[model samples]
Target: MTAPAELDAAGITDPALRAAYTTCRELNARHGRTYFLATRLLPRERRPAVHALYGFARYADEIVDDLGDGRPVVEKAARLDALALELDRALDGALDRAVPGGAMGHPVLAALADTARRYDIDTRYFRDFLVSMRMDTTVTDYATFEDLAVYVHGSAAVIGLQMLPVLGTTVPRADAEPAAAALGEAFQITNFLRDVGEDLDRGRVYLPAAELAAFGVDRQLLTWCRRTRRPDPRVRRALAHLVAHTRAIYRRAAPGVGMLEPASRACVSCAFALYRGILDEIEAADHHVLHRRVTVPARRRAAVALPCLARAIVARTRG
Candidate 1:
């Protein structure tokens, strides 16, 4: 369905609200390539909410990462704080009041607050996400996966929790929560591996310091590899280990596809396949992710998505 048709199907009639959702959909379409492809397989009415969620995430990530704008860390932190305050006010019914140039004035926040209200999504999950976004301005590296898990719980895991309400579930929501969160962690870990070079350029190292240390890899070695656009055996070994670790996460997350509502299962399953396929691409390149990003080819993406799209149509027909 087209964007306007999606808004109509979702019962979103207000002009400003539709505009807000449209802005979010644009962000998702432009930035979240694989994710946006998966979302297309969802029922049209549900697509706007998923777009809102991803839009909010991508906005916050841009603020923290600055997307090569060379903004000062203090400026980014201030922006993040302002966003958190705005989000808090937005969640507290400020948007319904429609105060001039307030929380509702921001398109991404406007859409997100609407989604949160509609789904009764917990406020704490959004709060936790901001806390992690705040961490990016200060924390540079994690000592171990345990320490990284603290960051991931806020950065990644809560995203899945936020999504559960919108996606619906076959079992109790709580019953499916673990795998949902695991899937989020897996996706983020894959990103960390794929973007290691870019993240290093941004002065952050997401991989666990201890894990790299075990393979005699450190920020210096990674930076050297990124600078020279070359790969080291030790660096390749470290990436190989992390890729295996990420595959285990994908395994842990696999069963949750069954836990989703049938109509939603195909969308999540397609995303699962595509994101996991990044691991395959990385491995196929012999884990040479230090100097460049790895991606699933467009042909491979189409091959995975077509079958799932057909499945989604059948599931919706049955429902």
Candidate 2:
């Protein structure tokens, strides 16, 4: 991945968003090697915006995951809160998203701000995204599936909603926004499941606490299972069930992709393909995320393109 750049603006301190998106061709690598071809194929105008979202998300995620600051949690939390407010200001039109088209600082958010302004995506979603990031400070367990979904709505769903207006181009709020949200939800859940061990190590648990209790899985068991060299039976079962749930989400979710204007399919296709790979990788790992995180290889990623490509081609031919 390219380095995160500093935004010329007062708020967008991360620039990786701009560097990775200088070419949509690079996004496939940012998400995974399997997604490049499809990204190259996105709706021309919207691909850059999708790249902007990816970069934005990467920047926000790094705030929690970087682990380099070596500061007290209190300090980190406060910093994140301030960053969140800045991001909100950028969204509310109070500040620019970047240095400016011609300005200095961070090229990414600047480019992104331009992208957001050109489209009609709201500022609220960006604010919600910060809230989701702040959750990393202490939110380890979820009380229920609904609770998890609600959190996912803010963290991931908002990212999708932010991109809808960009994809619509002409109509702006076109038919795909809901589908985009579904896509975001599907991706985030799959990510949580796939990164069980990694999240656990961070002293964060993303699995539903209530569900884990019902499953007879406790925190100690979760810790041991995740820290081990191989996944235990309980972890395997829980992960498999989660993958199955993800499949269901995808089923409900895929329809939203089909609802988009044909031009927008590539954006959905690339993002969908990456998460689909995660689901597939989870299955291949025997749902053993407690043992290790699984990733799709390039060859398989290449295969992912065929189905989507053929579908896109057929859609265009028919159109």
Task: Give me the candidate number with maximum TM-score.
Answer: 1
Summarize candidate 2's per-residue lDDT along 194-238 as a digit string, tens digits.
788887777777888777766577778988876667566776776
- In candidate 2, stretches whose alpha carbon ends up further than 4 angstroms from where it belongs are 1-37, 67-70, 88-105, 169-175, 306-319
Ten-residue region with minimum lDDT total, candidate 1: 94-103
Q: How far off is residue 252 in model 2, in Å?
A: 1.5
lDDT of 1 by residue, 167-218 (tens): 9998999999999999999999999998999899888999999999999999
Candidates in order have lDDT scores of 0.91, 0.66
TM per candidate = 0.96, 0.81
